[model samples]
Target: MRAEVGIKDAKVMGIGPAGEHMVHAAMLCNDYNHSASHSGGAIFGSKKLKAIVVHGTKRPPLHDKAALIEAGLRWRKTLQQYSVSDRYGVGHARHLEALPNNNMQSSLIADHNRGFDHNRVTQRPCFQCARLCPWDVEIGEGEFKGKIGHFNAGAEWLDTFWNLGVKGNATLYLAERINDLGIECGHFAFGAGVLFEAYEKGLVKAEDCDGLRLEWGNVEAIDKLLEMTARREGKWGNLIADGPLEVAEAIGGDAVKWVVHTKRGVPAMHDWRPHFSNMLREIVASGGMKPQGGGAANPPPDLKYREKWGPLDRDDPKGWPQSNVIAEQYRQFVGLMGGCWFAQMHLKPDGLNSVVDSFNATTGWNFTLDEAMLAGHRSAILQSVFATQRGWIADHDWQQVGQRFIDPVPDGKFKGFTIAKWLPEMVREYYQLSGRHEKTGRPFMNTLVQLGLEEFKEWAQLD
Candidate 1:
């Protein structure tokens, strides 16, 4: 296909056999290792669509080509100057002490530093990425010795390292192999952890996994499971491909306690116990379990809230209203513009005027900050409505607090902090600020009307 279509002209979005077989954890892989890893791939496979190939020669109509080029150059300069390490930091779970280990069984790893040596690793950025956030680790010893593998050493890296490294007790090579598998890391971790737990509890046996010992960090077994999941080969693979929530229900007997996920797939790798807002954002937003937006601490100097609310507190419910507003705006802006979040976060202190300017220059939409925000908010509402139509009720929108979060942080700066206590307050504040019903998480009639989404009011059944 690449030869016939020409690689430069053809843009392909494809799925593996797991997606072809409608695995719930199936993901769409595109060029540059970019994936839509939110269960949409299964739908495409179910429709018997192999791949979506785009070959376009015509340039998109730009309102002002010169202005757009100037904006691009400005934005690129901002990104190039930004220090990714200083902003988000590096190291695979080394900095975070409360990194969830062994499926949230413990928060601490005795020697997480030993999991992956920084000396043997090199920075590998994504396509045209200035940050170079991902890591390419060279394994010096073990089964995958001398193999170079890509690792996302950001917020998402902790889950992969924690699950395969600390919990599975696997080597860095195993983590690299998992990354190569192209499965959602969170789902893979949860599935592997649950199966291991089930085996430990005598709920499942070696025979169940085709005589593969379901032991922690068993490379052969984990590797086999990954293959089986992608190929949808056996009963175990079939069950696991369905994701942790379904697997738990299938296994029954106290398995639910081990699984961590919301109604939609596994949430991102962050343990939200320390930050109450993380939980609130995930629950209220319609994008499934992904983090909604950037953090509130160190507000961009130009953020209007700096003048009104002063310094923000992540844990304080009073500050969450403005925080949620800022988060929603940023989330919406990124979604609409298809820009990188890291760039937005790093450049935020300059405010979102740049985003608005770039967007206006490209699309010829004379939008002010408020208008741009409304556009973003409208997108969120549309997504929320789509989710609602797909049977995502209001009650199920919030994070399902499990035993992992229920168990207080044993030791940390925020020791004994419980997400359950502050969740409701934060959620309420988020709804009030975002103009959604506090209980239902639906866009209010007034909100719809205000956002120029009055046409969708009836379909959304807004009151």
Candidate 2:
């Protein structure tokens, strides 16, 4: 498609065999390694559409080109000053003892530095990104020797590393191989971890896995399983393709205990147990287990949330209301502007004022911070309504809460803390603050009317 469309002029987005087979964990990938990973790609594949290509001759007309350029430079400068760079790629998380190990059983890995070396890794930033976040790594020795692969720093790299490294003890080469195959790494890891747990309990036998040993860190078996899943070749592969939750249900018995996911799929790499705001965001987000915009990580320093909530404690339930309010606005702003999350991280110190200025400068709209925040709220409400229309109402949102996220961290900095006890209250606070039904998670009639979405009220049953 690129060849026919001319490489410079064309941009293409498509899914792989996993999507073609309607695998639940499938994702869409474009030219610059950007992926709509959270958006299920199987929906497109189910329509029999292979790919979409765009060749645009015209650029969008900016309200003030000089102002936009100046704003971009300022934003870039702020990001460069504040951005966190990882030296050892994903392995840096291990050094901080922050990497999720053994399917989130713990956060620390004692010997995570075994295979990763600074010399073997090179930083690779995305297009137009000020933060040099991603890495191209080479494995000097191991089963995956001589193989070079690309991985994003922090969560993206950590997910693959923890899933394969901490859980299976697999080499970094295997993780890179999976990335190349276009499989969703987090989902794959969750599925693999479930199978490993079942194997340990004798629930999954050798014949069930097509004569392959179902053991942690069995690199060759994992590779074969990934292939089987993509091709839908065997019983195990076919089952895993459906996703970890479905696979657990099919296996029955105690296997469900090993599965960790919400309604949509596996949670993103971050563990919510040690962070109350993160836990609330995970539970109340429109898409199941999808990362919501505002949380403890991107708190507006200028905001009085600190004065109101006192201190930020991982277990404190007091922070949820303020956190939810900020997150909703922040996420909305990022989505509307087509800006990355890291940009939000840097501009957060100035609160929404910086974001408002950028938006106004780009479009020549004189928007106050409150108006800009309402735009985000409007978008969030629409998304919630859409999810409700699809039968994923508030009642159904908490399906995986007890099974996956409620458990206390057995060890680490957050030992003995459980988000389960406080989840209901936090969720209620979120719904109330967002002007949605606390129990149903549906947008209130007033909320729709306020957002000028009065026409959608009846369709959403809010009328």
Candidate 3:
């Protein structure tokens, strides 16, 4: 598409053949690696659109270019210090041993990354972004020899093994393949894991699986299934093509029990039976967008509202609500000035203040921490309002969570613990702290007025 348009640097975002068919887990891929949700692709397909290409030649005016540069320098320099200048790359802090395998039957796996490199030279930094997270790599001697893949997340290549019950270069190769095909990898991996578990448990036979063995780590079978999903081929393939919930339902007989999802989308694998704050993030997010709840667990020391929030307890929520609210507010505030969430997670608590200084310097709008936090809370409430209007009662929706996650961790560091015990209270706390109703999570009429979002009063049912 870029070649035809005569713009070599044209940014292209579009669907693949499967997405064009409007398959259930269809997704949009931009450039080489960046991707978005299933419905995003389905929407493009629904309108017979294949891709949107843009080539920007004009630079937008900045409030303070020099100040922004200085902020950028602080962002980079501080990250360099915090990273130990040595711990920057894919899977740097990853615990490959803790990867969930075989549909959460076990939370441990032998390291199977297959010579995956994490050298800074392999780093694929974004356009003037502070974090040196993403990576680009070339395969030298494998089934995928000579192929180079552009992967976005620091965990991009690794998540394949995390999601699929597989190992090694095949997982990396699979990531590139599906990325090219433009189907969301996490959704595809979840569907594959469910089928693998079902096959292991005899819920489905090879005959029923369209003649392919659905055993765990069967890369060939996994590849074939992905092909069928993209094209919606055969019974199992067509079923998977439909989407996670749909495919699990088609498999029937406890297959759905193996799924761990929210709002119909299967987020990337994290057996959060152990990580309470992480689970809280998944449960409370309006659209299941992974709400960066991990922010609460390792909050910046200098979070403006730190004095008000309590400490985080990994296995409990007594202090979770307030801490998470501050983290969420800070996250939204940082995002407004175009900051990276993942990068901040690694910073010293004091390093976060740099982001604030950067924001104020760039905008010449020196928003005190309190003023910015107010805006952040408003942004968050806006999401709650949207979810509330969708009939998403906070507590009720949690009951619909997949059993795989709600069940206690069978093994691993968080062994035998489940966030389920405190989830309802946690959700309620999250709502109350965010200025929503104590139980319903909807913004109160006056709360809306305080946030300058009174336009949502009627929609929030607080009119």
lDDT of each: 0.63, 0.65, 0.67
lDDT by residue (tens digit), candidate 1, 1-463: 5676667658888877667777776777665545665547678788998788888779788999898777666666555333333322323344444566667666655565442443365665776756565555565554455777554434454465466444322445555554455466677777767777888889987777777887765667777888888777787787778777777777788888777766646666655556655655655643353226534654455456443553666556567555656676666766778776656643344446666678889899898766766777777677776766666655664545345544576565667776566656666666667777766667788888888888777654455
Question: Which runs of model 1 end up more than 4 angstroms from their true locations?
Answer: 80-97, 113-129, 134-141, 151-158, 164-172, 205-207, 285-291, 305-307, 399-401, 459-463
TM-score of each: 0.86, 0.89, 0.89
Candidate 3 lands at a TM-score of 0.89
For residue 323, model 1's alpha carbon misses the true position, in angstroms, by 1.2
Ten-residue stretch with the least lDDT total in model 1: 81-90
Best by lDDT: 3
Please rank every candidate by lDDT, starting with the best. 3, 2, 1
Q: Which run of 10 residues does model 2 get worst, by summed lDDT?
A: 80-89
Instruction: Report the C-alpha lDDT of model 2 over 374-412, residue by residue, as the tens digit.
Output: 888888877787777777666555654426455776677
